[model samples]
Target: MSYALTLEEMTPALRVLRLIAAECAHLPAPFVHLTPIEPERLELSLHDVDLTGDTFNVFELWREALGIDPDQVTFRVQGNGRTRVLRATGPYGGADVTLTAYADAPAAVTTTTGGAA
Candidate 1:
């Protein structure tokens, strides 16, 4: 991924993000972010985070926390790996919830240059 959303742990618009944070307290620490300009799209992205277990497990945990049905999630391929996105609306108005879970980036491969034409 070329970009990442970063935000300090602060109260977001309407406490919508805090609400979700409180709701998911049972899960391991999760980073939550809301665009100041566009508060409607709330996201919980797990990229570099260390969950101490399977990363995709967050999908299951979130489903239970948000009361989302298992079959409703959308799965798609992203590069050599995969991504799971669950789009949800409402625990409050003006909030478009999105949860994206993916495994760690593959380690860098070293290359050696030798021959010249």
Candidate 2:
């Protein structure tokens, strides 16, 4: 999957991730961790997740934190099956990141008969 986001979009995306990280930091053990490997990219890993909040909440929180128009930033998700593409848009910059749910192919199925027919 591929995406095209502007610099403006990237600002809020990063902000939201940071906010989430901060909130989780207070927890005894957080489910997700965000590590910035590059200036424009972050790595998010989840150990446990709470589904109490929806994606919109994240977007709103990001908007409030970044002091930007909620509509200015947009996030999109797309993929074929296991892999997904997430794109964020903002004023300063935008970024696209791909997430693979299953990095390896599924194991093949086999049929058994009386012996090995």
Most TM-score-accurate candidate = 1
Per-residue lDDT of model 1, residues 3-116, tens digit only: 243453223444666776677677765567666555456777655354474666766676567665656676655655534333433234246666666665445586779986
lDDT of 2 by residue, 8-62 (tens): 5556447655664575454322222223333354333222122542334443444
Clashing pairs in 1: none
The TM-score, computed over Cα atoms with residue i paired to residue i, of candidate 1 is: 0.57
Question: Stretches of candidate 1 above 4 Å error?
Answer: 1-14, 48-52, 82-94, 104-117
Off by more than 4 A, model 2: 1-50, 81-117
For candidate 1, give the lDDT.
Answer: 0.58
TM-score of each: 0.57, 0.29
lDDT of 1 at 57: 73
